[model samples]
Target: MALNIKIHKADNRGKADYGWLKARYSFSFANYFDPLRERFGVLRVLNDDIIDGGGGFDTHPHNNMEIITIPLKGALEHRDSMGNSSVIREGEIQYMSAGIGVQHSERNFSDSEPINLLQLWIFPKTKNTKPLYDQINLEGKRIQNSIQTIVSPEGGKDIIKINQDAWLSLLNSDAGLKHKYELHKPDNGLFVFVIEGETVIGANIARHRDSVEIKGVEEITLTINAPSKLLLIEVPED
Candidate 1:
């Protein structure tokens, strides 16, 4: 049997309020550290950030990793050293491959509206490929009663592609709807993050900011209790 570890709904996640930026992390990061909770599998970081109007993170450098950005509300203005500058709105996802090294900046485009986004970083199998940028939009489509799929490995109809053997699925779910995720490839595992509302995973319940790590299972089920949203990442278990 595979291991089933469920993280319950709790307010124990580390929080940092900078007035302009409000972030809640499930794992200890930077100034926030919980010896019990750090990271899971190849999924290293999950930062739920809310940037205030006209506020954003300045240029930063990253290397030898896959960085994904998903904006849930408002628009984000992005500029990279690779000469990629664009505006990402809700329903859109951006994937940046920091293979060697890259410098970038992210800012909320609206002066009166803040931007809510989730930034994820995954460790790559091999480092130093090449720095790249791409994005995809998922709008007006329902997947298992939800709306989301901004990134995938196979490069869906309009999704951005990454080098790693991983996939990201987002859903805006309806109550009573159950969604099952079956393993698509061997040596892979799934990480589920609750973005909004409430949901039940296996025999446990998870609320906002709660997460669960499942491995060696052929498939798992999810039941939404209300109109909710969530992110599912499928990556190598090892």
Candidate 2:
């Protein structure tokens, strides 16, 4: 299998800044439209956001989307129309399935501390079912220097469920750690994003916020050039 790979540099992402929120978009979203980056496989939106203290989005509607949020720095207070409310902090991940339709808002949990988070929206395989919410703290569950599966199609004890045949994993690798990641589904593609530090794949290098999209291959190898935090997202090609 030929490994077709493309790198999306950190500086190339679309940027938008409001008074309270600063965001970087990996794909076309909101008013930032890029025909070439409208979507990647089943992955629709990947937003890296920094929210000022006490600021947040008001309730918004969504349907047929599987939304996942990972707090990177601080805590996020999430409330939805489904009567689910929770504060997801660093080391915690949240999932919201907007099956038919749902309204929700996410605000900084602290009034004085800014928050950094990554949010993703993926196209669901089955829609118009039931809206749901789930979250998990990975503080003690994470295995150092290993790929920890956080989200998958099946909602198990540790992993949150998405409405698609996709998977999301995280790796906290030490410098010099060598890793190999294999796709769960042969047809699925992998989106590898460096959350922190540096990573090298073959001749490719990715540092803070940089991402690589690889498809038409079953697996890939990576070397942690620095103590790195990485996010692995796998989804169908079509």
Candidate 3:
């Protein structure tokens, strides 16, 4: 498969610590700029944010974009001007379509526990569709030895839908078994990111926080070496 790719090791990413919040940008942001690390495809930002107890970003404005928040650990109390307010904990996926305009804020509700979350921005297919907010809890998803669908268009099955055709999937290991993770979208490209543990993708090896983009490959196969967690994004190659 001929695919453009980038690998962000856990230690080599751009890190910024601001007392109450610590963040690592997989791609450059604000004053940080790396010509080779701007973004991947329509994926603009992949921010791993760790917010201290009762700390988070205040009201923020965004437009013409799709913002997705995936909490890896702890919980995030979210409030938007669209009349949506909720606590998104681990196993929950949240999406906000800042189509025309949207104002929102995120904060950790716990007084002593920190929150680890992933904030991702994706370019939407349609412009100015209207501001929206939605969240899905995937506590009932099951994928014995493969990846589970967490986000997709139209909120298909057990996935949280976004405004784009892109899809996000997660894989959690069951045991010491070789697993096959397949991307059904052959015309689209697959961005595979390992969240934890080690897994073999095709002939390449990927460890925690590492990723590989595979295009033109009809399917992908993963050999889970241990109890692993993975995230896969399928988006149009164009």
TM-score winner: 2
* Clashing pairs for predicted structure model 3, backbone only: none
- What tens digits encode model 3's per-residue C-alpha lDDT throughout 1-238? 4644445566777888999989887778866688887767677778888999979889999999899898999999999989998999998899898999999999997989999988888888899989988888887665656667877877866577788778888878854667655555667787777778887776677898877767776676777877788888888766
**What TM-score quantifies how close candidate 1 is to the native fold?**
0.92
Per-candidate local distance difference test: 0.82, 0.93, 0.81
* Poorest stretch of ten by lDDT in candidate 2: 154-163
Which parts of model 1 have CA positions greater than 4 angstroms off? 8-10, 142-149
The per-prediction CA RMSD against the true structure, in angstroms, equals 1.9, 0.9, 1.9
Sort the predicted structures by TM-score, highest score first: 2, 1, 3
lDDT of 2 by residue, 1-238 (tens): 5879899999999999998999999999888999999888999999999999999999989999999999999999999999998999999999999999999998999999999999999999997989989889888888889998999988788899888999999999999889999899999999999999999976899999999999888889989999999999999988
> How far is 210's C-alpha from truth in model 3 (Å)?
1.9
Per-model TM-score, in order, reads 0.92, 0.98, 0.91
Which RMSD does model 2 reach against the true structure?
0.9
Tell me model 2's lDDT, rounded to 2 decimals.
0.93
The number of clashing residue pairs in model 3 is 0
Per-residue CA lDDT of model 1 for 54-136, tens digit only, reads 99989999999899988888899999999999999987788889999999999999998889998898887778988989987
Ranked candidates, highest lDDT first: 2, 1, 3
Question: Which residue pairs does candidate 1 place in steric collision?
Answer: 146-172, 147-172
Q: Model 1, residue 63: displacement in angstroms?
A: 0.5
Regions of model 2 farther than 4 Å from truth: none
